[model samples]
Target: MKVGLIGFGKTGKAVATAILDNNELCLEWVLRKRTLLEHRSVPEFLGIQSDEPGLIYSSLTTSMEELLDKHPVDAIIDFSSDQGIYTYGEIAAKRGITIISAVSHYGEQEREFLKELAKQTVVFWSPNITLGVNYLLIASKFLKKIAPWVDIQIVEEHFREKAGVSGTAIKIAKVLDLEESDINSVRAGGIEGRHEVIFGFPYQTVRLIHESISREAFGNGVIFVAQNLAGKEKGLYNFESLLLPYFYN
Candidate 1:
């Protein structure tokens, strides 16, 4: 797959590494807000130095216009903020490119925008891309159907400087038909991520927890979704739908 990356943060670098390790995946180019000097390359932005033969050292550009015009890619994976993905989505839609957005904390407007974007090109929006968490969303639904009397609460922990409650917590809450108040958030200790769903009952309690060992979990998700989404039809898809087999099998 010829893939363009839209961010160069921690998770972005992890995904890039995964792509570098995969023979079928190619890192075509990366788009960022700031341009680096001639002394640096895309790897500098990703904080990775390429050592493997045949690995692609992609070019870096600040202009999305130039990229869309010149460097055509099979799909673009974005790990940036919501606004960056928002603008990129508009252009990607017009160019008929697939976009995998993992931007967190989307508002009503962003949600509406993605819906329209999907009409133009295939788009997968995921706040948390871990396979296990996607399974949790489905599990929450089954648990509710089997035990409606059980009260469920969510607790999500992230790094201390993390902003707002995690979208994973919100997604899980939505799956269980619970309000935001039912979620507990902890932002501390430079943790990657962890989520626990507790089912409370008078007679018994059940806890389902998923703790990310590292950001590689998300990189794995990127590969999984990218492989499945290539050349697919235009549609707004999420993690739950991608992992629907977990519920059946």
Candidate 2:
């Protein structure tokens, strides 16, 4: 699959590197906000040997239309901001390109926009796209279903620099039918990311934990989504939705 990447920050770079390394996926180009490394191939920047173009382009210089027209891709994996979709969502949808977005947050308006785009092409979005995180969420839900009276506590830990509550924790709470206030956030020294769901029963406590060791986990999650998403019907899908099938009896 030919892939276009939006966003080239730390996580974005990791996702691009993962794509470049995958034999089934091709890193076509990357679009970012700045022009600092414009036109530099991703392989050159990462110092890994690969033949894919993986060129970097700045949104300041290149319009989304120009980029898509010149370097068409089968899918676009976005680690960009919530507003990044506005740039290429419609264009890519109209052309039937798949979109996999790992943006951390999106309001109701952006979500509605994704639903609209799904009418034209496949669209998948996840606030926390790591496989382990989504798996933890699904398993927690299953546990809750089996034991509805258990007390559930969610705690999320992240780097100290990240202010406010963790979005992934909020998502976990929602999936388990808890309010945002039910989540506990802990900010500490350079923690990549960790989410723990504690289910307290009368006799014992079951904890489900997922820790992101590196940003490369995001890349791996995107690859898993892209591979499974092939030939799916057009619709808006969350990471859990893509993973739910595995738990079927």
Candidate 3:
């Protein structure tokens, strides 16, 4: 299986490492805003062999057609921002490539692009790919039934350098039908990650916590999704749906 990557940030690099570790998939190309990093052979550095950095390993094209024209990718995994994701989704839909978007849910226009894409190709999108977090999504639903009276509140912590609030926390909140405003964020010093959803009532608080000992935990799951998405159909899919059997079994 051959895959294309969008963005070359921490998450992107992490996913690249995981893909290199996998024998099943080959990274076809990476699309970024800038040129390839110094000393990293666009292809060999990414564990592939190709000459055109833009066409092969990392294409610095604003136009999607140029990237698609060069290499017909089987699937694309994007770790880019929302705007970048919107552009990539449009291209993937037009080119009929399966896309696994790691970015969170896009707005109306982006959804429209995805809807159009669904008519022709398969698109798998998720905000958080960490298997543990997806498991928590399930546990949250079950716990709501089991502990009927407990009130749930979520607290998340991330590295200071990380942007925005916790997308994972927002996702879990949405799964539980809670408002995004209800989720709290703690941006602080060198902590990698932390999430604790507390179910409490008048007398007690039961906490369900998932702390990211390292970003690698989530990165591993993203790679797993990329590998699993190979040769699949075109449609919008979620991580929890992918893990349904594990939770049910």
Which candidate leads the pack in lDDT? 2
TM-score of 1: 0.87
Better of 1 and 3 by TM-score: 1
lDDT of 3 by residue, 73-180 (tens): 778888887777666676777777787777765777776776677777877777877778777888887888787766888899988887887878988887777888
State the C-alpha lDDT per candidate.
Answer: 0.78, 0.93, 0.73
Q: TM-score of the candidate numbered 3?
A: 0.84
Q: List runs of model 2 lying over 4 Å from the truth.
A: none
Name model 3 segments beyond 4 Å from true.
Answer: 36-63, 201-204, 230-232
Going through the candidates in the order shown, the clash numbers are: 0, 0, 5
Error of 2 at 95 (Å): 0.6
How much is 164 displaced in model 1, in angstroms?
2.0
Q: After superposition, how far is residue 96 of candidate 1 from its true place, in Å?
A: 1.7
- What would the per-residue lDDT of candidate 1 be over residues 166-217, giving only the tens digit for each residue? 8889988887889999999998898889999999989899899999987878
The sequence of per-residue lDDT tens digits that candidate 2 reaches over residues 1-249 is 999999999999899888888999999999999999999999999998999999999999999889999999999999989999999999999999999999989999999999999999999999988999999988999999999989999999999999888889989998999988889889989999999999999989999999889899999999999999999999998877788788784
Best candidate, TM-score: 2
The TM-score values for the models, in the order shown, are: 0.87, 0.98, 0.84
